[model samples]
Target: MNITSHHGDDQVRIALTGELDMATTEQLRAHLDHTLISRPRLVLVDLDGVTFCDSTGISALVAARTAAAAAGSHLQVVNAHGITAKTMQITGVLEFLTTPPGH
Candidate 1:
């Protein structure tokens, strides 16, 4: 998958296109790591262009979420649909990662 990022004062938005599978998970993770270095208050991942997502991709998302939390930040997936949305929903990961622990 291809990834691009946009940074603002308190938020960073990462946009992903193509397939988010094993072959692209590392790239995604790398992008997340780089984005986290800035310590934005929120990290928004835009999955509108994501056509597919495998288990590894899902794992990567969760890992990013954990990393953000540990860094005292937040992460959210936006514009997810089709296979990307379905995979997350069926795996119970959509709510798991989107919903904060206390909420």
Candidate 2:
């Protein structure tokens, strides 16, 4: 996957492209870890460019949300489409992952 990020005063927007699977999940985790260190109030993950997502990818996203919660931050997953969105919905994580920042 290709990940790019933009930092703001209280938020970090991460845009991801390509497949989100086992091979690329570690990369995403690393990015999240690095970003969360500063305790940004919001971490927005944009998955518009992610055409495919496996179970491992969904796990990664859920883990991200959990990690953010543990850090007293918010992680919002957005812009999911096609199979990626379907997977999230079918797996019962669509709403959990897509909750708006700040509740």
Q: Best by lDDT, which number?
A: 2
Clashing pairs in 1: none
lDDT tens readout by residue for model 1, 57-99: 9999999999999988899888889888889999999986666
Report the poorest 10 consecutive residues by lDDT, candidate 1.
94-103
lDDT, candidate 1, residue 9?
A: 82
C-alpha TM-score for every candidate: 0.93, 0.97
Where does the lowest 10-residue lDDT sum fall in candidate 2? Answer: 94-103
Q: What is the lDDT of residue 23 in candidate 1?
A: 96
Prediction 1 global C-alpha lDDT = 0.89
In the range 5-100, model 2's lDDT, one tens digit per residue, is 999989999999999999999999999999999999999999999989999999999999999999999999989989999999999999999999
Clashes of each: 0, 0
